[model samples]
Target: MNTINTYRKKRFWAAILVVQILLFFIFSKLSIAISMFERFFEIQKEIHQLLFSWIPFSFGDMLYLLLGIYILYSIITFFKKKTRNASLFKILILVNIFYFSYQIFWGMLYFQKPIVEKLPEKEITLEKKKELALKYLEKCKQTRAVVMEDKYGVFQISDVHKIKTEILSQQAKLPSFISSKKAAEINSLKPSLFDGVMSFTGILGYYNPFTSEAQYNTQLPSSYIPFTLAHESSHQLGFAREQEANFIGYLTGIQSSNPELKYSAEYFTLKSLLNSIVYEDEKFVENVISDFSSGMKRDWAYEKQFAAKHQGFLNAFFSFTNNLFLKSNQQEGSVTYSYFIDLLIRYEN
Candidate 1:
């Protein structure tokens, strides 16, 4: 009886996995199905935010913590003769439930449609990328001077709450052709509970599909927080692609009345543009970096110091795993910044 029941358990999850894989393949090719899923996501996001957004703390982070603990407990008990079968069943059930929920909530949106298809097509060129880089470099310098700074002269957001408000406001203003999803007004963004560890992992922020919450590391340098919020909030807007989120974030921030949000967004664009052109024209990139104003230089220096402090094996491992995760979801991977630059250049022209 025990062996038969165990076989049934394995078979049930195997069937679920096969069904999900088939659905994913179909979704990738079926626009109508993808559109239906996008609508489902809108309804799901509303329900999730209603349940979780009111909590001042991160319920999603706690959910992750408890999940980790449960998994660890299962692993420890798996070696025990009396508990091995039960532990196995528990983990299997958990995996199946989470996988199915994740797909139903967020995974299908990755296959909906690429943002580039909605925009005017144009030839991407090296010259155009360089021009944007110089433009953003100057913008960053000017914005940096205007935004508040810390006692040490590094860039600091004057008011995080205002930035959050501005990001939400700007979301509603995004071009209809770009993002047609209903704009979310719920303040679901929260600071992560794993911020101490996230700093070393190089994760800026992540959107929680299950809870419709955006989680950012509170430990980030002040300059990174506002733009990171905008970027993560883009994910909440149903953009599953990383670069698309960045592009949406750029749109969200570039038009904001808040200087704090504008400075962070402009700086991020400058960095992305520079990264895009550095290999093609290293000299130009260096010269542009050298031209940073004293305030911008101090801000850059502080960022470098923060990154240096957290550099280690964990950063590399997280980066590698993150790249794989992105690619699995049809993204261009974290190592590539040109997709956002591609959107930028095409949109600019």
Candidate 2:
């Protein structure tokens, strides 16, 4: 009877290992499928306007509810499951640890190469690049002014419904953005895992041209959330280029009546603009920095303090990931940001 029981235990352990391996393979294949699917539509320039042409609910708002439920369940489970002996709890904890370990080992295995490809290369002349970025910025300002003045910047769900009404009302005037067939396809893309994120709320979502998702940090200061959301959402709309997304998101937020959204937009754009200028001319940066409004200065200080708390983690993660990103993207350094200078100049010129 003892030998029979031992044999059963051994079989169970082996089966568990096999199940884990299968899960890893399944996750990897699913990741690949998502990547391939994103690319198929991404390469099409006209696909942007149709992306959110139809959706039942905003993805981010639903995720908030889901996360809330998960947290509540975890709390309830903790209180309900009180074990008298710590050994049983420890064993259960180890099982959880093993599961998490297996997930991390393979869940993100398919992402590194694509992420690396998005890193900026140093092939372009810095001076010329700045010129290009400035040109783009100038054009963006004009484009933004037109969009803001003409279209409403929706904040709440009510606002979104209102906008939809306006769009439908002007169907005659609305240029056919997509063919009837493609329109159906775009509308069919319900807000899934690929859409709606509370991670960063500025403009971009799962839209990194390279990684197919936004860079999200949940532990960030609450202050940065709105802007981050907009930024990432912009990426989702096929704005594979960073500066364009930044510019569009800033415009979108600034156009909104919401004070928080406006502030986020202004803060992000100002930071990008000032940083560019500062890098190009330190004396100019010093003068501009000294002239900041007291409120702006306070905000800056708050951001700095908050950022400092996460600096070590950011440094380690960025250094490693950026290096990989650069290598994958055929770049020399982890300076994906530097390309924005070129983008700025392109826009300006």
Candidate 3:
């Protein structure tokens, strides 16, 4: 009878897993209803903010740490236990709960109307990209001249707290046509405790959907940090897709009165534009890089060094995994920045 009862429990959990998988397919078919998840998003933000905003450190990171330990412990115990079926049943149940929670909290946002759908459709030309690249080049040079530099002549943010404040303030000013979500003043941004891992993996920053927190790799070059913060905060504002977050981050940073923020955004814009056009017109890309101000050149060199130091098999593996993850969620992978370039062209035009 005990053996029969154990088998029944295993069957029950397995059925729950099947139901959860079915729900994913069902949700994937309902883009219209899934878009409505933004309404629930506001409530979720409020609850998460109330619970996590006052915490000094990343509450979300703490949760992740605990979850990791629990998963490892479960795997170890499963190998040691005689009742392998029961252990499998427990694991299945845990996975079901996690998948369901993820969908309710964040996964559904992937089905929202694509940003490309909101823009006027037109073929963007190579000339237009080149023009924008040159335009941002001038902007970067001009902005780079005014921002503070360290003793090493590299860009350095004077006040991170002020930058965070500026980011929050700009959220209210985002173009209403693109985003209508109310800008909440919850201060849950935190530097990642996993900075070493992040640097090696090429992950600039990430948003914690469960805690409504934005985590950035503080160890990055100053030029990358500000824009990364804005990008992650874009996710906090319900932009699940990476390129959408990039576009929104551009809007937030470009409009800032803060010179550091402006310079960072302009530099990233110039780099991204040049990267997109480099294959088509290597000469033009070379000229653009040559035009970078002395300070911007130093920052670029530092970024290249950082990337070189971290380049290896682990980086390749992470890129592959991230690409698969993005594709699974209906997004272009890390290898393509064209979606962001596409959005920039439409908005700029």
Candidate 4:
């Protein structure tokens, strides 16, 4: 009877897993459902941030740690004959709960109308990208001149507190025509407990859907930190597509009064535009790099060195997995910058 009951429960959850896949796929196409989820997310995130924001350390990180241990233990139990059936039941139940919670809390937002639909569309040209790249390059050089720097002369963010405040205030400044989502003023950005591991994994930061927290790697180059926070915070603001989040983050940063953040935002924009143009004319890309201001050059070199140091199986593996995850969520995969460049070029025009 016990074995029979275990099999029954396992089968039920397995069925639930399949149903959830179909349900999310179906709901992803309905504008009405997407609108409802968008509203629900704003309220749910507000509540969750209110509950979890007080703790200085990341509760989401701890939750992930515990969840990882549980998964490992379940796998171990699968190998033992006495516990195999029970373990299968538990695994199925866990998977069902996780998938349902993920879809409800964060996944459905992926189906929201693409931000591009809200903007004026124009034909993007390589010349337009190159022109914008030069414009941003000059913009970054000017912004970098005023920001604080370390003894090494690399750009340093003296206070993350100021950047967070600026990001919140800038949220309202986002063009109403593009994004109308409500922005909550909670400081839920956190330095991840897994920063060391994240450094080698090619991940700068990530949003914790379960806890309504934004987690950034503390070990990143100073220039990357402020923009990374803006990007992850975009996720908290209900923008799910990676490139859309980047666009939104760029909007927030470029509007900021804080120079640290403005410089970071401008630098990222310069890089993104250059990335889109690199394949068409390699010499043009090199000339632009050569033209970077001395200070900007130092920062760029450190970023390259950091990327080189982390090159190994770990980075490659994570890059592949992240690409797969993005595509699974209906994004243009991790390797492409064209979506963001398309948005940028059209917006600029």
Q: Which segments of candidate 1 are over 4 A away from where they belong?
A: none
Q: Relative to the true structure, how large is the alpha-carbon lDDT of every model?
A: 0.89, 0.43, 0.87, 0.92
Preferred candidate (lDDT higher): 1 or 3: 1
> What is the model-wide C-alpha lDDT for candidate 1?
0.89
lDDT of 2 at 286: 70
Model 4, 1-349: lDDT tens digits are: 9878888888888988998899989998999998899998988999999999999999999999999999999999999999999888888888888998899999999988898988888988888888899999999999999988888899988999889888988987889888899886889999999999999999999999999999999999999999999999899999999999999999999878899999999999999988888999989999999999999999999999999998888899999999999998889989799999988877887
lDDT of 2 by residue, 1-349 (tens): 8556555665565566677667655655675754554455444424433443334544444544565675565555556644222333433444555565524422333332332233343444545533443543443333333222112231212122232222222222312321111211122112235222322222223332222323344344433545655555554444333444454455446555544555555556556655656666676557555655444555566667755654554466656765675464334344345444444333333
Candidate 4 stretches with Cα past 4 Å from truth are: none
Q: Least accurate stretch of 10 residues (summed lDDT) in model 1?
A: 20-29
How high a TM-score does candidate 1 get? 0.97
For every model in order, what is the number of clashing pairs? Answer: 0, 45, 0, 0
**Candidate 3's C-alpha lDDT?**
0.87
Q: How well does candidate 3 match the true structure, expressed as C-alpha RMSD?
A: 1.3
**Top TM-score model:** 4
| Model 1, span 5-38: residue lDDT tens | 9878877877777887787787768888888899
